[model samples]
Target: MNSLELGAIGNCSIAALIDGAGTLVWGCFPRMDGDAVFSALLNDARTAHDPRAHDPREGTFSLELVDQLHSDQSYLANSAILRTTLYDHHGGVVEITDFAPRFALYERIYRPPMIVRRIRPVKGRPRLTVRVRPRFDNGGIRPEITRGSNHIRYVSPAQTLRLTTNAPISYLIEERPFLLDRPVDLLLGSDESLQAGIETTARDLFERTWDHWRSWVRSLSIPFEWQDAVIRAAITLKVCNFEETGAIVAALTTSVPEAPETERNWDYRFCWLRDAYFVIHALNRLGVTRTMEDYLRFINDIVEEATEGELRPVYGIARDTAIEEVVVPHLSGYRGFGPVRVGNQAYLQVQNDVYGSVVLASTHAFFDQRLGYPGGNTLFEQLERLGNRAVALFDKPDAGPWELRTIASVHTFSAVMCWAACDRLSKIANRLGMADRASYWRREADRIHTIICEQAWNPDVGSFVSTFGGRDMDATLLLLHEVDFLSADDPRFAATVDCVARTLKVGDYLYRYVAEDDFGKPKTAFVICVFWYIDALAALGRRQEARELFETVLRQRNALGLLSEDIDPRSGELWGNFPQTYSMVGLINCAVRLSRHWEEAF
Candidate 1:
């Protein structure tokens, strides 16, 4: 939980991070964007070695094996359930299993914001100490506690958490090591009594949750090669989806800096329209259209309620538009970097690319017959309002796709996406037999395309630049062929990809841009940008080089085959938010693009 060697468990409603030793460290309560009840991932003031410290180590739920020798951890099969086996010096072994309960119950998904832990002896008798210290308001409040016969309640002004365990209450309260004569179950959830016994509930939920995830993985139409990596990434992305509202977040934890001591941290708990679209698009390629169908519900609601057809760059999981950014003063960030932020301020920024993101994401509703509800005239009319916004702002200046806070420029990527919006809307109109609307959108798309060609191509850069008339390179320009703004055979498109690679490539990674922003020059490569470059290489018939680079990038994933937002090129260490959706989307998209065709493989 403190670093990249962490495994995640989630029920699609909420997620928690556990270290390799199986300590449950970071988890928000009630929902994904709610208060992080276990915030030790950020505040690493004390380790579980000294549970007797003065402050008593506020943000962890640890089961420490006394006199531990070594530990091994991995997920159980293809599920989110994590299993950690700890060995003690005295020839004792214990296995800790962690998961969040998610399965079919009551004819629907029963995903309570709960974490379940089951600890059992695998070999000899193992001595273990249990610690459950929860903090609230980002470690601002230390809760008052009360103990029942089999449950303990942690009470604070903001939230109350209950822990129902079969272990000795005295040993748990005093944090004493005890011999594991039998298996113990811990269920951390709401302040409610257990309908069934602790062991019964944990056992049943574990089986069902494991079945749910494994069966879901079985349903995916994965590539023939890199099956494990793709499955892990797909599951990770699914974990990021807030199933209640169908809003997929950018990443799970925030304020994990892009580079240490750089102060480049920003909250990534909310959904950026652009990121969500890519995530949905990647998953759709895997035959996971249900995710898109669910997200369509969240998106169309925003479209219908859009004011003046204006959309923000990001929104909270509950469709909140005003997610004001504020610093959580009490807690330090991951690795002691301060300024841990909650809620994103990007919701207030004018990112013109969002117009294209919305239209592109919604266009599938009209074309996909598998979806129960086909988009109609009302939805298409509502989308026209967004297309109008695109037409108005395509060549206009805004923050661009990178979300540079202190600068505004007419980003070529944004303009091209606007063109894509127009282009797709034209196709959707044609599908609906609206000939006039189709013709109008076609003309608009063609007009935008012609202007982009004239304005974005810079003679000095010898290719398309990031901003119109600007001389710098952006990795996004490598995507000109991807969005159909240019053909793969177009010499200009090949030159632009070459220019971006020469400028932004660092070792095997790709930086989004080298230009200075609100924070100084970027020091790490954006993970998704690397995948975009790989996709470009594939488009230009450089599949061999692309496959080699893709293999190198796959080596950068953590032990669990998960990636973050940024990577330190020299050290190959991951940084930024944990389990980044953009990185996961890239994993899926690239695998689909690079994997040998199923028939060829066979």
Candidate 2:
């Protein structure tokens, strides 16, 4: 059966049944960046026809694969618990459920060796089919599979996987098509045996996972107006987090094109300094100070490990700064989009805004007194040095916030962040009683504010332009309120917000920046930008408008309450990478802001 509409239902049926093989269609394991075991999402042909296909529907197979089954899926309320039900034309019903255990005493820095998947027959005695095809190292290497008494093992140099079955059934491994198919009552762990007192252990582990999530959710103090949305957004953020390092990736998948068939797809599975500050603000407001501390420590470690002139705009989960962009010809892009890319080359581009973003985060940390380590003050000093560097290079042409393929004049957003960094440094130093350096930073902040107001704002349009001496309006300027660069009620701020509402709003969603003047045509609606607009509206006392817009954007969340980097407004389908952290962060912040407003106004 050629099925394409399948999506995550609650914490249930998160697994995808592709073709006839029971290969994990798209899962990142050992960590999010670790090679995919089954990457059919990247290259279906290679996955389906490779020598390692696991097709269970070969001959007299107990499992009957149905392609056209109408399916509906949802998660258990306020939890990542997903459930998907399949209704067949033959009046047979089946349900598949999937979830990873969330809580264990193991250090958050280590990953457990297994993912649990359970399938149950709801109505009829529908014969269950099982296929176990695992492509290791991101489908780049095929492992040697060995059969155990009640389990199967795929062993390779970098990793090992073991699958355990419950019921007795015939198992077969094919060579040309590279597949393994079997009929089994239950499919269990890949590396360990489940028959010798392992099933109970697995079930207990699953329960603990659910309990961990529940405890975390219950601890949230979200107000009534946004309880449900905030919970979902918070959980989605947790999913994007690399538990081991406390660093959160911007998105799950890589190379989902921003503009279809174009080379605009970039890997977003790294932590951006720009996201760190807002992340702290959101988590802290929600009373999740631990995550905030983790992020602060991660940032400090990055700074400590850095050599002079070696600060990067972003880094991998493990703090690696090497992300060279490359296209994989082997895999056909999503929905026929071509040239699926692996790494992000934007790492090499100069984005002056990162310094400001880091400083903003540090400023928030300082105010909250959540700075984790002894070197927190020293790190702030390093940031001030970077601020000096920013002032020297601020006027030069470089890639802006969008990291456009081509360099341009001084971007208004970059300058605004430069202003924010100096502004934050002054605030932090003064608060810490360092009066000597405070005046220098304050003067620098004043100079940047004046320069941006004079050179970046266009009096003709009464709105801040995207670049110096440019006429285009950018959605990024919405961040003026976020950085305290401009008051939301400021007339100039209102004019800029109105400019964005007129030009950038695509339906209820917003675009990152104007596309005609830059590389690649403008495409999907940037989900996070829409949330930024909602936050700005709320800050301006436009609560009704903000709530309405926030509801509209929330409607675009996927079946599992997940969000991608972009949304196709015309079709309302998720377009960019899956479960983007920035989108979730925006959701949490907007919900918190609007909910507080609702509570007070009511």
Candidate 1 clashes between residue pairs 3 or more apart in a chain or in different chains: none
Candidate 1 lDDT, tens digit per residue, 202-309?
999999999999999998999999999999999999999999889999999978889988888888999899999999999888888888999999999998899989
lDDT of 2 by residue, 67-97 (tens): 3266666666666655556666666566655
Worst 10 residues of 2 by lDDT: 8-17
Total colliding residue pairs, candidate 2: 23
Q: What is the C-alpha lDDT of each candidate?
A: 0.90, 0.67
Clashes of each: 0, 23
Q: Each model's TM-score?
A: 0.98, 0.87
lDDT of 1 at 362: 94
